[model samples]
Target: MTPVLSRRALNRATLARQMLLERKDISVLDAVSHLVGMQAQTPHTWYLGLASRLSGFEPSQASTLLENGDLVRVVLMRGTIHLVSPSDAAGLRPLVQPILDRDLQNNTMHSKPLKGVDLARLADMGRRLLAEKALTAKQLGAELETHFPDSSPASLAYGVRNLLPLMQVPPRGLWGRSGPIAHSVLSASGSLSLDEMVLRYLAAFGPASVMDAQKWCGLTRLGEVFSRLRPDLVVFQDESGRELFDLPEAPRPSEEVPAPPRFLYDFDNVALSHADRSRVLTKEFYEQVRPRKNFAPQVVLVDGFSAAEWDVEDEVLSVRAYGKLSRADRAAVKSEAEVVLGVYGVRKVVFV
Candidate 1:
């Protein structure tokens, strides 16, 4: 018989799998790879997100990982920047190259300057310059114009970034440090191949549909491998009867799984994992909590749903309730908030 999972059950299972139910005992790099990649549009906050999920979660330790070759910051899935481990980025980048290419062509912001020029050649030149030394986009941009004469500064930066498999080079992802935009090409990282990273995604987040995998990695060219692996996968259906995919060995816990108060970053994958996205935060909750359409570190959950949103500003933590939060649920939220506040050495939390 097919197993049924309640909303909270799924929430707890997801939390456990995501390492949010309890902090994990693993390296930052391992954590990043397991979760696919943390939502890292604004890079520094991404670093913080990873820290929050790991045991001890030392921000400095994660920074050091970024400083060394252990971690990297680059755009992967959906064509957005993410703080990924070196091994993960190397493999994930090539897999997502098509997405990178499409974004380049569709870029209303940059297409004019790169009209007729070859993308491969631009990547070649960028790969060369970034081989020995990392350079800021400012430095890269100046040289790009001199080389690609037809391209404007903005267009040149955008074109080169898309063409070359570049990483936001280190000191860039340090704990409290947000460096000016700088990068090194993919070749310098010397990490795993794209094939391996795609395999890793399937292993960690499988039993997931092609669209689910595509959403996770920001790529969709896995037909051959997925076809080969289909027999090994365990399939299920959402309430709407849409087929859902997953690995047989992966966590499919009972619906009564316990999900504690989780403080998630704005770009967290849990909120974005499924196509429907009803598993985590609802559309109404999103509209209510998020003042702007897109924002991060949405730190509140209760009864398997996003109850409210929280933020750290001027060293103060502020929370806004989206809907009704029961008394017991409010206590749980306060407890988790206090722990997070302790990280920042805040006096207390204020719910507004």
Candidate 2:
């Protein structure tokens, strides 16, 4: 019988591995790679994700890394923009190409009208155009229309985007700055296999179900990959009898382990990576914390589960709890809020 693990145990294990249980002193580049990548669809908000996990993290440090090409923002895993190291962009992007490929075929924006369009020709032309100069989606589409005049510019641009793995260029994701979200081709090699991808996911966010891995990457049919890796992994069962996979030596802390208060940025991976988020959020708070209406909730995690919704407005960090918190948990949350608000240079903290 696979050892059954409780939700609290899973929560602590996740926090320990995610570097949320304690701030890690690793470099920004190292942390980015360690987490596989940080969801970065939002321009500047993702920086807060790193700040909360790393010791002495500064916005300028990550901004400088982006400027110097040490880190890049690109569409990967689940076909969303992620802030990843250049190496991850190379190794992981090619593996998730199927997701992009399917998007080109099935997405309403391109599929119907582009029915017989020579995608190979389209991809080649797009690459050549990007090779000449980085361009935003609008700019690239307008140019693509010059050759394929019959196709709508939007359709042509959408095709190129799905067919080509374009890296969003710098100055766009830099801290306290905004620039055009433009695309340039990635030149790095080293495409990893599906098994490697699964292993990487397990290393970073494991003791997870196969469904969890599939949900995280937006790719399907990975049961074979996990099955092949089973012998080498440490397996367990959750209360629901679903099997979970983890690295053999990965830390599985006791349920009673200390979990400090954490303020999570919108779309933080710890909240989004797992299909069964019961480990990090209760059913009652799920709808409140889930991304909706183009907004990702900023949440307060107390004792490894989301306990409140939080936001900053007019330089005041405000938190609203789901229910009454214990005296100790309340104090821990306020203490962490102070540190977070200080980092953002906010002058006030309020609990409403």
- TM-score each candidate: 0.90, 0.96
Q: How does each model score on lDDT?
A: 0.70, 0.88
Check candidate 1 and list the clashing pairs.
9-255, 206-246, 207-245, 207-246, 207-247, 208-245, 208-246, 265-297, 266-296, 266-297
CA shift of 60, model 1, Å: 1.3
- Find the 10 residues in a row with the least total lDDT in model 1: 187-196
Q: Write the per-residue lDDT of candidate 2 for residues 1-352, one digit (tens) a residue.
A: 7899999999999999899999999999999998999999888888888888989888999999999988988899899989998888889988888999988878886788688789999999999999999998899989988988888888988888778778888789888788998999888766678898899898889889999999999998889998899899998999999999999998899999999999999889999998898889886575564555677788889989988988888888898999998888878888988876566777888889
Error of 1 at 218 (Å): 2.4
Model 2 — which ten-residue stretch has the worst lDDT? 284-293
Expressed as tens digits, the lDDT of each residue in 308-347 for candidate 1 is 8888887777877777677877788888777754565566
